[model samples]
Target chain A: MCNHGIHIMEEVKVIEIKKSIFEDNDRDADNLRADLKKRGVYLLNLMSAPGSGKTTTLIHTINRLKDKIRISVMEADIDSDVDAIKIKEATGVESIQLHTGGMCHLDAEMTRQGLDNVSIDNTDLVILENVGNLVCPAEFDTGAVRNAMILSVPEGHDKPLKYPLMFSVCDVVVINKIDVMPYFDFDLDKCKEYIHMRNPKATVIPVCAKTGEGIDQFAEWLLNEVRNWQNK
Target chain B: MHELGIVFYIIRDVKKVAEENALKRVVSVVMDIGEVSTIVPEYLTDCWRWAADKEEILKGCQLEINTIPAVTHCDDCGKEYPTVAHGKICPHCGSTRTWLLHGREVEIREIIVPNN
Candidate 1:
């Protein structure tokens, strides 16, 4: 060891360790998934950037499936509880507000805490409207069985090129605000092509949350996914 | 977007490991960051410096980052290529059946402790 050295040096101990910084979070997410499966709870993570009509869509979705299946929502935000308030007023179902305390995303442990605060004894579906950001939320797995994302018409169709990971990780891509399609010059075919290019297995649904256009298909897909998850 | 939040997670993990191993202090912590990953190394280290100093075990511990190149594996050609340059397409075979092989890592490679 001294051949390449300048002179004699003090002896030192070298310990080799290779561990993932995300190991703990991954393990926690796995445990939470197992626990949710055991309890017959289908958790869906609905993600999108700010002003993507996530709340409005969720309210409509809840109105459609509330009678058939017991549903709850975990509204996560950086500091405000306005979405949770709106959800409670609209759905009247159990809605828990999770403040990330200036954090951009919610991790598995944080989701678990949100779950503990709400009652899931007889709930069939739990939707987690993760913090309204496309970048950070895609990096963390919150133990959700299904991942859904929304992109509004105003955000343009080039979103897939800029944020590829979000599209790749998502199971379904909701192109919200389709009613404004005539005004925005947003080509639905081109956008769908971009999403398919990144994620071939993704289901692209174009909907208008405000006018309730194409929401039936979204509801049907969600119910089918929940049913499949429950059966599995 | 939240490098400080990630730094807190790292500190919590390092603290747990230190406690389990009965380590009083640490010299450095080495990380393997992927090129395609959304994390910014400079932002992470900056956040780490602000957070680690508050904790006793990691007060002056140095943070080292090792960047891992992003690579993609093409199913059609059975070859691997750089993901940043070529993206989801296979450069060798021009196929769209390519998947990422590496460069999404957020790992801790080593934790160096001072001589006893």
Candidate 2:
């Protein structure tokens, strides 16, 4: 046999790298959380479906808490500056837009990149308005101290049942558009029950972002959370 | 789609492994994809092909997926059943106190490198 320049390998080496694809992202998220904790900053990841009043709720909450809590916002969308602009214009908060290129979700690394632009030292709370989707956002941790989702009245009470993972991952479930509850078949109690079933420790708050009703409760919850996070 | 994002993660992980082992090229990557993992295997492989070819180390790398069957355990009946057939609710006891035992996994099992 004439041996050419091509060398015949002895054996193929198989490396046993049994690891989850999300492992790296999860570790990054934990590090980010710890860093934020050390800096006394609370990062809140807010997720919802499109047109679920996430922006409106944020504007309302930011307006109420801006005086007390030093707040900043990061809006993550596939491609849009509308949210960032709206949030900045509405609340006059330091807001930045993060385009995920074409990604459906924002991982911990992307969250950290977005946070780099914000003045983390002066900010007590940084709110990440995650891309409006239930499934993908829940799959990736954005290194936030808390996770919240707004379930509007028009979206029905069966959302928790349909998207169990989203419900399970959420620390708080904000039921927005409660003013239209009379017009819709959405049952608030049933919705709370379903949310509790998925996550017993989840705090459910009903709010009308349009009317500014129940915004105080949400604000109070957030203020206490930020205080507790900083203290701990 | 999420498949593209997942492909990027796989490429990053593979490149890191290659760097650690001082390997030049990878031949195949094996993955254990659970049935209820919500990742379509076809889409994943298609995305992997499009992304892997762009990487010098994974130019023609093949992705092999092992589908793990979805299983659910019933707390009430103390029994296990196929999750796809009966979801959330236990079939034997007709109870909603059922949780997934396994089937939501997206793991990279191994990588085969060509011996230099």
Candidate 3:
């Protein structure tokens, strides 16, 4: 009875902190999203491999949509602001340049910083041109409502199979360079099949930005996505 | 190519854990690296040496990397095999479809710290 009077404390407090590798970037992206929502702006992360005509697509889209929408862009590259400069010259839209330094992808923190450096006042569309890499960019979510991927026709149809994760993460798949389809052996049905297999709900829109073919559908779809986001 | 970037993440996470535990230095880090993560183990180790060497609190910190193979399981015949060799197809059942059960992980599983 005397020995039973002493009690042993075996309950230790265990703190749970679930953090991701890109936690800092995710937080920054969230802040950017909140800021955009308050400003009534739509943010889109455009991703693709090198030479996928992402810059060219932007040039065309900005030219087409500038009349109706207040468009701004944040361009990400490894070393130069060449794309940003090109966009500025092409569309006369206020553009901000982001150099990823040595990183292959642009995180949300970097996007947020780039957005802060620019003036997006009364901007309806804000496109963040992600660095031209397929893999690493997929892992880094920049708090974009729509993650769009640019897949040029000549890059091979098996690209979606080689990198399924990127295709899976994308909200929209833009098949660029439809103008070059005559020279290449790119079958439209095969590409759509691959995308559907990876992500059934993903939007696949083929566009020849050079000739402005399917640009209207792309614009209308983007507007719908923004409107849907607003409604939500 | 950017394994150094991952090292920064490891350092940041280790610092947070060390601060909470009142540990003065981090001695070692254990990671469960998936085979299909596209991360080179040699590059990761090299990056760890370069970055971890620069830190005074973790100069001699050892990196323990456990390679997790990408294993896929076929639904038709119920076969499990390495993803590298299988190529998403089953050997016994000969199916072009299989689900990746493991491997795709890139996480710092544990950290060893010096006594306070």
Candidate 4:
């Protein structure tokens, strides 16, 4: 029995490898960012919950900026090409859909695959509409030059306090559905304050996607972002 | 679902390590999962069992998780506290100016392989 135990112990070996699971993904993301920078392609990863007016806001922003900049859109979903069709039909820009095969979020590798299908050389900006989730998407960087998120008024001002990680990572936070703020208890000032609490430098843009109100500001921000990216 | 996605990443990493060492079969994978890492241990292991079995090298590989307790540092009071209980706030001083020092890690500590 002692010989048997020794034999079993000898057959098993433990190797020390203290590495973060996200390390590989993070490295891939950095490499992708460098490649995009070399190509002068600004990839914006837009994330938010489902029904947060991401598609509508994209349509409005694309319509405003398409004339000035060569734009493309990549809509990521578990299943469905509806968003891809909508963006193309509404703005007439090159748009494609990426199905995540029931995955919750798009990692850097998946984003790279999606970018392969788009005309990166001809396009100045590629806005990737990430899977509609506030949790998982924030954890995985999609190698975008910048990260943005939408928070509809109905989702409440307390969202920033709840999903702190999501708010913290986003460079810009677009507060949508502000037109209905009068009916709901969503306080605009409080929402901004909460967002600032989580992320001091996060630019908060409030817009009503349904009425196209305050979309010009968002468009202006995107234009400046794209211009700065190209020049940098 | 999120756990399943993480399992795929783990599998990929382990496979690369196995290839580098010329390991034919992985006996077990040890992980360091933080308290606030947002990964449920139960869900992670369940996902691991399902995904690891599909891979030839990782067939029947055991997944062992070490829970790292989350600790937050208070910038105001210069004290430390448990993050899971206080959560972004310093409980001793009631200050909102706090940051997580650790416990957001989803790391692979090591891998157990057969000797020969």
Candidate 5:
């Protein structure tokens, strides 16, 4: 049947494309930062390991400063709406929950998606409680104006030495559960030294989320930081 | 793991490229992962294998990782050293005024298609 027909060869083609994997997320984060700045919103990305008392500290912070500034919370977890619900019932402020569908960390794009879920434009403070993980969250920029981490006393003081990247990337470090410092072998001064060794510029705030021992100071510092960020 | 999210991003970008080029299938995706970057190549490949095969075009697509050695440049000493070995401190001059030169890369170096 093909006696008079010409034979044609199927050719495979190779296309070359080089691009950064985080390119889209990074660009989105930058844009989100700019948008937040224009809208006078200060986003604080809070990260830490599981059981770091991030929620307790955030609740304390919200309780202390909600009257002064409009505060909203975006709680991200692998699978749980409990934190967001607790934040709402406890503080009576705007709250949203983000389920990562099993991812251990929140990237800039995920942060932006969460921001879109809530009213981020009108709020003065947007606290992103990132998924409770030490390693992955530090590597992803969540488009927050500033980044902080909560290191509880129970988590040990050598966390900085083990997770240097988290300590180095954070702008502020909160040493939570300081009320139990007497029971644990954690040394505050030594922890501070370790944090400084990793990041000299990080502002270390010691607090007890349970007793609210240093929540006032922490709240004051956060207020000032938010105000300063907005002013800038 | 966050590597799973990254694998999704890779699949998205690769599919977009394949669509634009009118390609039917992809062979492999080469990535330049930094030595100091938080992404582990093994985990990335594991996630890739799980996620990429779900896509019709990326079935059995190989994920090749090219590790970029972490390097840091010292501002005070004007020297470049391995970042993973010495960290933020300059080894030659013992200066803390050092910044990363390259090690945070998580980029796709090449998208390989069958020589179709």
Candidate 6:
């Protein structure tokens, strides 16, 4: 096939894949969505900054629903499984910690692997505690029906302005660490106003996670959302 | 960063394609990165230089990034604007109501190869 001494009217054919490499991850996530739907499991993607009391909120919420429902969590961290260990110790439930190694975000493939270890059958809620980052994690879709973002008081109210994409993508916003509201420069009303401007549909809930304040309302909202999905 | 994992995928896929097609090297890769995707171009470039050097096909390939701007359509005024700005509401109408027209993607558009 190498007889091209000169120009001999060569033919060229380009086969376009027309498929995204991320499609593999999307396919996996779609499978997860189907599995959750079949099992009547409500999946929640919990996102926030590094110290936004995600773990604390998870602890308090799981404690409230521990006896009522079968809850499991997939915790993502950069290095250690410390968060997963903490979640296990706090909730006394089955949780798999996914180590993203040095990656700042967790994509659908990572979540799918974590889901393999945790059984969603006979489970009511499957919570994915995303990596402790605001920007990158928001770009990924983990096939979660509900997207929850935590904003602690110490992180300031200006977070909505700085990282608008994160807040905009979330279905629910939790103002965690409400007990330290007075000590910080955060204005509760101002923060609420910013969030509303960013996303009209997102429900903002303030809670003192460490002190179990307003958690019942938050849990009720979450259960209602899950119930609607289950009923569908 | 998310770019590192993206780089690995790019290299793996491109290398496999080139090998199957009997190609020596890749000259350029045209990638479509959505403006709202939160992937920093600088970080991606840095990661590409480090990761691409390891792949035989993409050892010297130049990654040309074509940014696709996320357009927002205002439901009230029915106008289109580049929604690359964070929390892209309507620039004309002060409505939290809007629709995402494009962006929110990360895909390879085309590839340029060396005929040699």
The model with the greater TM-score, 5 or 6, is 5
DockQ class, candidate 3: incorrect
DockQ of each: 0.49, 0.61, 0.15, 0.65, 0.51, 0.33
Off by over 4 Å in 3: A1-20, A23-35, B73-81, B89-98
Tens digits of per-residue lDDT, candidate 5, B51-108, equal 9989999887778899999999998989999998887678999997777889988888
- The sequence of per-residue lDDT tens digits that candidate 5 reaches over residues A131-172 is 999988887788998899999999899999889889999989
lDDT of 6 by residue, A6-91 (tens): 21233423334444657776677788788789879888999999988999899999888878778898988888888889999988
Candidates ranked by DockQ: 4, 2, 5, 1, 6, 3
Q: Give the top-scoring candidate (TM-score).
A: 4
Residue B90, model 1: lDDT of 87
Tell me the lDDT of candidate 6: 0.81
Clashes of each: 0, 0, 0, 0, 5, 0
Tell me how far the alpha carbon of residue A231 in candidate 4 is from the true structure, in angstroms, after superposition: 1.1
Name model 2 segments beyond 4 Å from true.
A1-11
Q: In candidate 1, what are the lDDT values of residues A1-232, reduced to their tens digit?
A: 2321321142334445577767788889999999999998999999999999999999998999999889999999988889999999998889989999889999999999999987888798999999999998988889999899999999999899899989988999999999888888798999999899888999999999999998888999999988887898
**Candidate 1 ranges with C-alpha deviation above 4 Å:** A1-12
Q: Write the per-residue lDDT of candidate 4 for residues B4-114, one digit (tens) a residue.
A: 999999999899999999999888899999998889999999999999999999887888899999999999999999998878778899988788899999999999888
Q: What is the TM-score of chain B alone in each candidate?
A: 0.95, 0.97, 0.89, 0.98, 0.98, 0.86
DockQ score for model 4? 0.65
Q: Arrange candidates by lDDT, highest first: which order?
A: 4, 2, 1, 5, 6, 3
* Model 3 error, position A136 (Å): 0.6
lDDT assessment of candidate 2:
0.92
Score residue A162 of candidate 3 by CA lDDT. 93
- C-alpha TM-score for every candidate: 0.93, 0.93, 0.87, 0.96, 0.89, 0.85
Give residue A104's error in model 4 in angstroms: 0.8
Interface RMSD of 6: 6.5
Interface RMSD of each: 5.4, 4.8, 10.0, 3.8, 7.8, 6.5
